[model samples]
Target: MAFGIMMLFVAILCAIAVIREVKERNFLAVGFAGISFLVFGWFSVMTIFVSGAPEM
Candidate 1:
């Protein structure tokens, strides 16, 4: 659940960054947005695959 929240936060931040980049006409912001999305995806996948409890 924490990871999910983190992903949401990153997504919101990315959206804000993209909007700012569009207004400022900066291409580097787009790169940062891309990296943020990749990190979000990675965290989501890890959260799904990694369980807190071990299965016997």
Candidate 2:
């Protein structure tokens, strides 16, 4: 849970960066930030579905 939260924070940061890059009209930077957002966002989602807790 904690790790996922951290990854989520990073993902948020990347999303913000992507937004800023887009506003600045930086194609290369936007592409890099967009990729970063996708990777981190996927990791966060996977972490949420597959946790360390055991089933009953």
Candidate 3:
């Protein structure tokens, strides 16, 4: 869960990076950021789903 949350944060940052790279017309950086976003996002989401959310 902790790992998932950390990855989720990283994924968000990568998403922001992707947008910045696109705006700057840096396709190479965009590709790398986009890939990291996808991989981290998928891993985080799956991890959360598999572990289940905490109850309030």
Candidate order by TM-score, highest to lowest?
Answer: 3, 2, 1
What is the C-alpha local distance difference test score of each model? 0.73, 0.91, 0.96
Model 3 per-residue lDDT tens digits across residues 1-56: 89999999999999999999999999999999999999999999999988886766
- For candidate 2, what is the lDDT? 0.91
Q: Write the per-residue lDDT of candidate 1 for residues 1-56, one digit (tens) a residue.
A: 67766776777787788778878888898788867867786776577566433667
User: Highest lDDT, which number?
Assistant: 3
Count of clashes in candidate 3: 0
Cα TM-score per model:
0.56, 0.88, 0.91
Better of 2 and 3 by lDDT: 3
TM-score winner: 3
> Which residues of candidate 3, in runs, are more than 4 Å off?
53-56
Task: Provide the global lDDT of candidate 1 against the true structure.
Answer: 0.73
Is 1 or 3 the stronger prediction by lDDT?
Answer: 3
